[model samples]
Target: MSMIKKRRMIEIQQLQDDSEKQNVTRFILEALPQWFGILEAREEYITESVNKMFFCAYDQDRPIGFLYLKETGKDTIELFVMGVLQEFHRKGIGRALFYRAKRAAREKGYSFIQVKTVKMGIYEEYDRTNQFYQSLGFKEFQVFPMLWGESNPCQIYVMTL
Candidate 1:
């Protein structure tokens, strides 16, 4: 059985090769400036993803979305970063990538999954991001008032596997 899934001409695949992960991570993040506008932060994500679990969603041969998972603890994993092309939003690519990552985490014996984002209401872009995570059953766990900065407070969301 393959982890690859295809629907509506979009396909999702888990990438194990480091270079491919870096390539896809850079490509997808570059395509999503609204979510990954900070050059420093985006570069950090791309570099870190090379050593994390990576999954990519592609339309034909064009990578459109990606998710990276990092182990946060013996029993916990975090969705370090994720993004889908703006044109592909609400079309299930993000959801598919998430479920794939979740399944992989459970198989690896992870008991909890978490993600962090800019706290909602501070920005419209992040408000949608907050809602997306909530729609996937992630519950708000905490808020770090100045984790990112005074303006971009960080909100953590978690789910039990």
Candidate 2:
């Protein structure tokens, strides 16, 4: 199946500073935890002092979606959080953010990408999340109980570039 192509007017760029980062907060907050299953799981973490990699999807000058990532190893990265405003979902914004991040990470010499979410049988939202990652060529790497507890059953997926 063909994935959506990013609109010509839309740009995906790395978040450069505090102000550009701040602009996407409202859009990120629009998605529920059921949607992306962020570790912070709320808006309060957007500005938190975590070592993060961010890419924002902008339509013209409006921030529509974002992806948050962190280095888990010298050559591996974790997709920490990602979301698009409900009105903007499935319009290729999230897919654009994802592929941009992947390309950037690969260019930076990272070979592996990983993202964690609530396991499939537990949350309906995360089931789609897992499927989305899989569609992008990520595979099930492992399932462990340490991070989010037993019921959550953290599912980790990995992709190699």
lDDT of the candidates, in the order given:
0.92, 0.77
**Best candidate according to lDDT:** 1
For candidate 1, the lDDT comes to 0.92
Per-residue CA lDDT of candidate 2, range 1-161, in tens?
99998645888888767656755754566555556345554655576414467888877887778887788899998887787877776678888889989888899899899998778878777777888888888898899876777678889999897
Per-residue error (Å), model 2, residue 53: 2.6
Tens digit per residue, CA lDDT, model 1, 1-161: 78976556888899999999988888888988888889999999988987788899988899999999999999999999998888999989999999999999999999999999999999999999999999999999999998888999999999999
Score every model by TM-score.
Answer: 0.94, 0.82
What local lDDT does model 2 show for residue 32?
A: 50
Question: Highest TM-score: which candidate?
Answer: 1
Residue 88 of model 1, lDDT score = 94
